[model samples]
Target chain A: MTIRLFLILGLAAGMLVADPQPQPKLLRNGLGQPPHPQAMVIEKLRRMNPEERERVLRDMPAGRRQMFERRLEQWNRLDSGQKKKLEGSLESFRTLTPEQQQTVRGLFRKFSETMPEEKRGDGRRMLARLRNMEPDERKALLSSPRAKARFSDSERDLLAEMAEKLPD
Target chain B: MSPNTMSCPLQSGNADVLLSYCAHMLDEERTELIEQHVAMCAECFALAEEQKTVWAALDGWESEPISAGFDNALFARIAAAERSSAWEQWTAPVRQWLAGDIGWKPALSVGVACLTLVVGIYLQNPARPVAATPTVEIAAQELEQAERALEDMEMLRQLEPTADEEKRL
Candidate 1:
């Protein structure tokens, strides 16, 4: 029975790894939203002449250039509120140690890839709630039965790590 | 019969001279020098004796004479193999598998059984929702956007020193 259970778990994990899902973004304004723009970089880049902008992008690999261009386009699309929310998140993100930043990135990727779509709203909401709570409150909410019913142990851990490192 | 003052050949990493001495291939002066060193060094003495024994055994061994038809027989066998049908070549592995010469069948059975079990469990659990590819693709794009945003912010932060200096002026 133990061996069979291990086999099942191993197979499940293998399937998740093998799935060709895209990783989640490290920083976004919210679900169904575009990435937040940094005012300084966007303004500086925007102020550059076309030739200067072209020169800056000329040396980048094609995919990197495209990604940068896509981001600039997203920046162009965002209104003030979305940009402000993202700026706040980005400020919090910048305060983390490099290792912590990497951990948050990994957790976000895991959440996006593994969590069910229906539960993702709950996951995001829980993350937002945890972000505002005191450490003890966060701990209480995470260990509560509501948290248990809604998320797996790993998902809860993902939320906790994100909250600790990227708290508002 | 003074103790040899030269470095031990093995210690000096120059065992070629010792090997040459064992094979009796060295000139008289070099052989004498090595012999003196070997006599004073037990490790070199053992190695030289082992090499000499190997040379003696190899020199005493004889090779069997080949039949004159050996080359022709080998060429004929090669031609016969080359002339065999492509179908037979392709089907050889399948034939081997059917004949139980391969070990993949059992492993494959176990893998299939495991996959079936996982799929059954997954389907039985209605709570586990599968994410569609389009959603994942969108998520990936969003991630790229986020990374780019961070990079843009970092670029601006690096330029902040210059911006701050301007503000001071």
Candidate 2:
């Protein structure tokens, strides 16, 4: 009986080992290979200035430049979704008004001087929040009576003291 | 000498020459080795190609000229920061001294002031009796009774021990 029980246990272990559970498979490109380098090179070229693109082509050998051009051509043939994702980042550069850009630059300078090691994510989060708000909502929040009343008596006194130091 | 002896001397001499060449600091020999390896090895050749592509991409990146006001803005920020830091540096010691001195001053001053105020109030009261000799005699008797009671209780406590405590002894 003991021998029979041992054999049963061994058989169960063998079955467990032999019949492994299937793992979820990640979807692959139909070709089962990474995208061509020409596609990546073309995307990079689109973001570069004409002068920079000319400089790179001039610096490279004819064979390498031909390879790069081939890649650029392939990148132009990508679907709209892929193209839009790459192009969307370029909009970030254009969306800011000159004055707002100046303000952001000033904020970065202040951050560097006061806290050089500060995580960039903090500023990014604040900017994201600001960007997500409507202009009217932002203005209302800044000028609210609730904001003025939020200070304690001592804090209000401190603010008054600070305000007195400011130029009229 | 045998071929092994001759080869050993040659190998050691080559190694010495190679060491003196400083292959890492002087790139010529190292570059030759890398070129040879890349030409012979598919993996190394692929890496060399990738490196060329990365270098080309890096060369293509152009940073826009910093705005004309950038320097003025940066300097203003630095100056403001310096002023803030200077103020903090100047005030920190004063703050610490004030905190340490003020923390104890209230407790000490209030205690002394209260004592003085109590004494003044007691002296101003006309209804209070001035029988100091009789009061001192009564206080001495009360203190003696309290001391005797404490001694008697201590003695009784010492004599009484639980069964477990006795076992420990």
Tell me, by DockQ, which candidate is best.
1
Once model 1 is optimally superposed onto the true structure by TM-score, how far is the C-alpha of residue A50 displaced, in angstroms? Answer: 5.7
Off by over 4 Å in 1: A1-38, A47-52, B1-148, B151-169
Model 1 docking category = incorrect
Interface RMSD of 1: 16.1
What residue pairs are clashing in model 1?
A25-B143
True contacts kept of each: 0.04, 0.00
Worst 10 residues of 2 chain A by lDDT: A159-168
Index of the highest-lDDT prediction = 1
Q: Model 1, range A42-108, lDDT digits (tens) per residue?
A: 5445455666667656666889778777667666676766566557656666677777767666666
Task: Give the residue spans of candidate 2 off by over 4 A.
Answer: A1-168, B1-26, B85-169
RMSD (Cα, Å) for all candidates, in order, is 23.9, 49.3
TM-scores, each model vs. reference: 0.37, 0.19
